[model samples]
Target: MSCDAIGSRLTARDIGWGPNAAHTLIEKVSFSLDAGDRLAIVGPNGAGKTTLLRCLYRGLVPTTGSVYVDDEDIHALPARKVAQKIGVVLQEMPADFPFTVKDVVLMGRIPWRVGLAGWTDADRQQADHALEHLNLQHLSSRTFSTLSGGEKQRVLIARALAQQPQIIILDEPTNHLDIRHQLEIVDLLSSLKLTVIATLHDINLAADFATKAALMQDGRMSAFGPARTVFTEDRLSGTFGVKVRKRPEVTSGFTFSLAAS
Candidate 1:
């Protein structure tokens, strides 16, 4: 029910990345959060939310600045070390190689494996635990490629959990889910003990899930702070081109009306 406070901190210092100044996707964005904070990065499409996320997870090295984990530059760490600390669930992925759902979940154990040894019993147990946690045990024997989008998303999250990572970075984690599953995912994330950084298109869900938020606009961080503060009506309306209202009496607590042409 509560985060572990593993004692490590994730900080982004003046991070910027792009091929050149003419095309910098993310620019000079900076923020810091402790191990348990759920920081939702929200912005309009092309606002560079994904780009900033990649930089944070070291999926792409920033052209400027650096990301640090407890004073150690993330880029300077070994890939295995990074993998050990950070688990990633990207947007819906295609699997062509014909692996079972269990096989895919077991892949998370690769970080803990040595040079060429096969999966250990501990690996299978961890994978089983993750599968049960995500309620994917029924899909374990199914071919990963044959599953539905929502099922695949849950399997991917199970894989991330199998990693037993300190930080989990997800890009559009709820893309393929329905309303029930979306709420389940949100609740599951809110209950996690690790740090979470994710991009969300649904403003209300983001507000409900995040303890802190970073609002991006045109490759820059327009606002960063507590979720309620960063997701003010003005910020959401101006950034999303909609009239947004806070309705604290409701579950998600926000409502939106589109802008008139």
Candidate 2:
């Protein structure tokens, strides 16, 4: 099916895959994402969380079922068209390249550009807006390799936003940040009002930003629903094999917790 038929920003049905392995990495995974919804995906290490994101981001095709973006089958759409609508910030970025922060972020706009022509004013404007959104305006001219780990992560996020996609997928985006920056990124994404799908090891942060949550284990979905329902002590403990406590937030309309999984 074409992406335009679903009217959802992202969708997956019965997606599964495994190569020369005993079991499939992901199995019968089906989900749909409406525009502007935030979904936090939680799973143990090797639970196929990263692999699932890869499939959605068009990095790997599923061995069965299908992935759709805005009603178009991801496999059917051109890569450039897919890039324009779905931006991704991965867990780790490639190193050894000497591009500047601005240079790296601007790469997001390549899909919209033609030939080897110079970047247009609108391109610079979009890149600048993204940098500003991440509060990295001052570091635009800095070399990407010279930045700290957290800074590089934010820059990659900026690059994703520069694409002006309808949805953004972040895989362990907060893996290397201090507490303050981690909270900042979560807050920023929450306020952007875009469809966001994130795989986070930090349950508290996920609960803080997500409107909905999905728990995965053993290559299958364990549970998924509103944050309030999914983050309960019982549900969390059962999934992670840990003790957890949920505390409501005074400002935000959500809760935070510590899981002893």
Candidate 3:
């Protein structure tokens, strides 16, 4: 399937969130993603990467600053309207979903539903396109609860694509998979050719797949630029507290040695 023209610009303006005066999870985080730009957010655990993501996708409204789709503030838009423009694939998914793969993918059309109406031909067609695009056609009639981890993840992405959003935001797209599945998913994400923003634990995968990169440290943006520029040895070593190494001869290129206890 072809990439959609809904590839609009997404921006954040020093957004922040906190419950109390003493506890800020994410603060002063900012970045901009143009059409067809894939940005990977990489950082150590507890660096507020997920918190920052929540703010960007309107999963939470920041206590400060704003997230924008082109020129309109996302928080100000209706939730349904925002859903029509931004589709999110979360890090964790339900252990079991009581539906077929195609039915689950069709759920992405919920935001576009008219009052009390049945599924339209267009909805089914869009879902089919998503399935084919992600190579999930063979699994369309399978029970979602029976699929393997990798298959489940692919189905979730297909669901997101069925939304026909301008941008797709994924949190840790390769969380529980083995090396092969992880590489498979990473390659699929790279080939999407849509505006994508994802949080990845693997910096090497991030560097290889993303056009842009954002490094988050302690709820702040350490750097934001082309992936190669932001994934340098110094930044990786310092932010992750490890000895980062580059092996030009290797496929993954960058690796790390653990810090002394």
Candidate 4:
């Protein structure tokens, strides 16, 4: 099935999160995302990329500011309502589950199901469709714990797709995939029409997959704009504390590397 066009507009305004004023994890970060936009949040470790994503998906509340979905305060909405609007796939997975792959993916439909009812036919169909879209139909009956890292990642993505959310937030989507799977997953995400917000570690992958890039440093936004414009050598080097250089080839797309000091 084609992606539904329920893409939402997400906005963050001067958001700050932390236990106390002296230890802010994310501060004064603001950005806007329109429908059909793919945004890549890139930064080094401890740059608060994950923390910002937590705020966007309402997993963690901001201490000082707000996140809005299509002008509605996300924190004001019910958690189930927020789940209906935004789907999230985090980097970590639960340690153990005795359920089959299909069963795991079907959990995504929880937000849509009525009170205390078993899986309906429509929910099963949606789960099946999501499995097929991710090419996991053949493994639908296999135990989720037996799958490889990349397979688990794909299963999580299939779950998010089954959620049928307006906005999808993925933290380190390509974390443990092999190079080929990484490219394939990134390419697949690029084809979707929904609003996507992902934190990517690979600069080249971010450059290829995202329309816009938000560079974060020390819990603050260092730059936010078109990927090509924001991922310059100077900005990358400054944020990552490494020398960077961009190389353009005749046939291949732009490639980046750490320059020799």
Candidate 5:
């Protein structure tokens, strides 16, 4: 599927968010992504990767600088317009509502829903298709609250996919997944070929799935480029303040070993 038909390129310029209570979150960060580009944002905890993604998704408006979709300022657009362009899956979510798995996934269609704003036949079909894509078809009828952590995560992603967004943002998407599901999610994303900006903790997974990688440290973008240049030992080690070795793995294209910091 071509992403060109989706919204325009997403860009951030001199973005920063902060307050006296919270230290500077993002600092003069700038980057742009075109359609069909899979860009992974990697950093250690407190590195402001989430803050930067929030700015891009308009979850938190930048305290300084600006964000744009194509050339138009994102803040100026309607929320629905922005929602139509991007879908975000947060690191941790607590859904207490008694919604069914299918009901939860179907919620993604809300953006497309207007006056009548209800799930259409096509929407139901798309929802099922999304679940099928993630091998969650069997769980569609299950209660979301009853599913396992990994199952919930996959279902959430399926919901995002059902949205049919041009760009998708994920915050630590692999948080609670097992090896198989983790790889499955990454592999699925790599195949979708959407404009994906993900906050990933797994360096090797980022290297394997992302077309480009952005290194964030202390609320600033340290490096942004192809995986080969950003995933080097020196860069990863320096950014994380720990030894990270690139090991040849049987399953994954690359793996990282933690050494003395």
Candidate 6:
């Protein structure tokens, strides 16, 4: 699938969110994403990565500025319409819903439904394809709450894929998983043709998988650009408050390690 066919150009302009003038979780964050760009938002805890993502996905309305999808203001669009264009896999999971894995995945089709009726055959096919894509086909009939953390994460990703959105936003998609699973999840994301924006804690993974990277600090965008340009030792050390150094590569890809204090 080409980006022109499945992706939406996403832009956030001067976005800020806070309850009052005295407090702002994120401010003056702006970036534009073209089709096929995989952008990673990287920051330490309390750096507003998740908050910014929430604003983009319409989970939280920005207190200032706007987010546009394909040149349309996202806030002005209907919630269902926004949901159709942007698929999100959040960091938190639901509190033990009784639905099976397939049932939960089928919920992705709710935005497309025209009436109060149950899912149609087309919805089932889409859900099934998503399940297979995420390697969750064998677990379709399993209870959602019974799955392990990695399984649960894949299920949520399957649900997002079932939505068939133009863009996908993931908040820490690799959280709570082992190293192998983390690599697997990131690898799967790299293979997708859709526009992807994610918050990644792993700097190495961001360097390898993200075409663009944004560094956030104290509610501000410190840097945003191509991953290679933004992931340098000076920038990484400054943003993270650690002495970082690029390790000598024994392999093809770049790697970094913290220098001793």
Candidate number achieving the greatest TM-score relative to the actual structure: 3
Ranking by lDDT: 3, 6, 4, 1, 5, 2
For each candidate in turn, the TM-score is 0.93, 0.89, 0.96, 0.94, 0.89, 0.94
**Candidate 2 whole-model C-alpha lDDT, 0 to 1:** 0.82
Query: Model 3: which residue pairs collide?
Result: none
lDDT of 4 at 189: 84
Which candidate, 3 or 6, has the higher lDDT?
A: 3
Model 6 lDDT per residue over 11-121, tens place = 999999998888999999999999878999998999999999999999999999999999999999999999989999999887697999999999988998988988899
Q: Report the alpha-carbon TM-score of model 1 versus the true structure.
A: 0.93
Q: Which residue window of length 10 is worst by lDDT in model 1? A: 1-10
Off by over 4 Å in 4: 250-261
Tens-place lDDT per residue, model 1, 1-261, is 112324257999999999877889988999998878898999999999999988888889999999998788999999899988888998848756499999999999999999999999999998999899888999999999898777888888889888878888999988767988788788888888788998998888898899999889999999999997898989989888899888877755778899888
lDDT tens per residue, model 3, 1-261: 333544779999989998877899989888889988999999989999999888888999899999999889999999999999888999988898999999999999998899999899989999999999889999999999999999999999999999988889999989999899899998998888678999999887898889999998998999999987888889999999999998889755797899888
Instruction: Name the lDDT of candidate 6.
Output: 0.89
After superposing candidate 5 on the true structure, give the runs of residues whose Cα lies further than 4 Å from its correct spot.
Answer: 1-8, 20-22, 248-261
Q: Give the winner by lDDT.
A: 3
Of the two candidates 1 and 6, the one with more favorable lDDT, higher being better, is: 6
- Candidate that beats the other on lDDT, 2 or 6, i.e. the better one: 6
Q: How high is the CA lDDT of each candidate model?
A: 0.87, 0.82, 0.90, 0.89, 0.83, 0.89
Provide the global lDDT of candidate 5 against the true structure: 0.83
Query: Least lDDT summed over 10 consecutive residues: which range in candidate 2?
Result: 1-10
**Regions of candidate 1 where Cα sits further than 4 Å from its true position:** 1-7, 95-97
**lDDT for 115 (candidate 2):** 87
RMSD of each: 2.3, 4.2, 1.5, 1.9, 2.8, 2.2
